[model samples]
Target chain A: MPIIINLDQVLADRNMKSKELAEIVGITEANLSILKSGKAKAVRFSTLEAICEALDCQPGDILAFSSPNPSQGGESN
Target chain B: MNLNTFFKRLIDLAFYLMVPIVVFFPGTILYVLMFPEQTIINVNIPYVENGFSGKALLFSMGFFALFLLFFAGLYQMRKFAGLLLKNKLFSQEVVKRTHKTGTFFTACALGSLIFIGINSLFSYEGKISVTFGSSNFNLLLFLLIVGVLFLLLSDAFKKALAIKEENDLTV
Candidate 1:
């Protein structure tokens, strides 16, 4: 849940539409929508590479990890 | 007829045949309980006098569980064949049906075990002199193994279903 996809922001920065990005990346618009909505369980390396190439953005720009419980830190030592 | 239609027809025939057996079992049980002297299905089961004893109750429970196992197993097979007919493989329905079938088989195995224990009790009481046979023991073992196999299959199907869902969700 901490891993968030900022696909909408990346698309906005690139001034690109989701459908156009999907066409360039060789994925369906529905799948692109799933990615945009952050409902995807995993993103394949090939798919990430394709999306990066299409949108001219790094993977870091699209994916960000923010701790849901920042104070807890999730570390058990 | 083509192979697809042939298999479909075969499953349909099996399902139809099983329906009457499923229907007849409980009906026959009820009839035999009501009129023990009457001949049904060319066999007359003597009525157990003095109401239902613990042994009778357990035996009936075991019989009911086995009937349920047969009904549920056949129903799942029918559903699976229907899914094949519809070309659907990765669905929750398939997973659920498999799990239910496994559970039913497991219950039937346990039920048969109860029957063995009660049979021993009845033999000790001298109400019936029938000894438990090797064939019955083998059948029990077969039921247990089959039950465990189906349970393992259900678990595998569940894992496959999860993978399919994750793959479908991956963008």
Candidate 2:
């Protein structure tokens, strides 16, 4: 859950609808919705590639990682 | 017929056969109770002179309760098989039915052990005897092993369902 999907932001920047992106990427609207909602357990490399190609953006533009407990820092015992 | 079709037909046959057997069990018990002399079930407990004695009735009732539990487990198994036939193999309903089936079987097994212990107290008259040669003992032992195996199978099915759900969510 620490990893976030910024698909909406990327889509907004590209000025394309989710339906249009899904059509180009060859995936169902429900699957696209799952990816956008951050409910997806994983993203296949082929899907990521397809999305990137459809949106004309890098993978980094769609995916972001935010620390869940930033106050605890990265140290582990 | 193909394997899937054959299995489906087999399950359907088993389900239908079990329905009548389950329905007949209570009727059989009632008949045995009403006319003890004409009883088809010969429950021979040592030292109990009459077949319809209080101790014998107690044993029979306890056994009937356990048999009901076993039948309930079988019903759950029928539901599980129905789901499998429909290809809803990894659904929550399948897991729930399997777990319920396992619980019923395990409860029946434990109940049988307790029933045996109580029966032994009356039959042996406070004397502790270990007899492994009895058909009843072997049947109870088999039920216990089968119940444990079903419980293990349920756990495995639960894990498999989790994996399947995770796979489904992966996009």
Name model 1 segments beyond 4 Å from true.
Answer: A72-77, B1-15, B25-65, B124-134
lDDT at B68, model 1: 71
Q: Model 2 off-target regions past 4 Å? A: A70-77, B1-48, B117-121, B124-134
TM-score of chain A of 2: 0.90
TM-score of each: 0.75, 0.76
lDDT tens string, model 2, B1-171? 666567667767866776775677667656767887884576454433656677666666676788789888877877887787788988888878888888998899888888877767656766665666667777877887887887888888889999988899988
Clashes of each: 0, 0
Where does model 2 sit among the CAPRI classes?
medium
Chain A superposition TM-score per model: 0.88, 0.90
Residue B153 in model 1: lDDT: 77
Candidate 2 on A22-77: residue-level lDDT in tens? 99999999999999999999999999999999988899889887767988564221
Q: Model 2 scores what on Cα lDDT?
A: 0.80
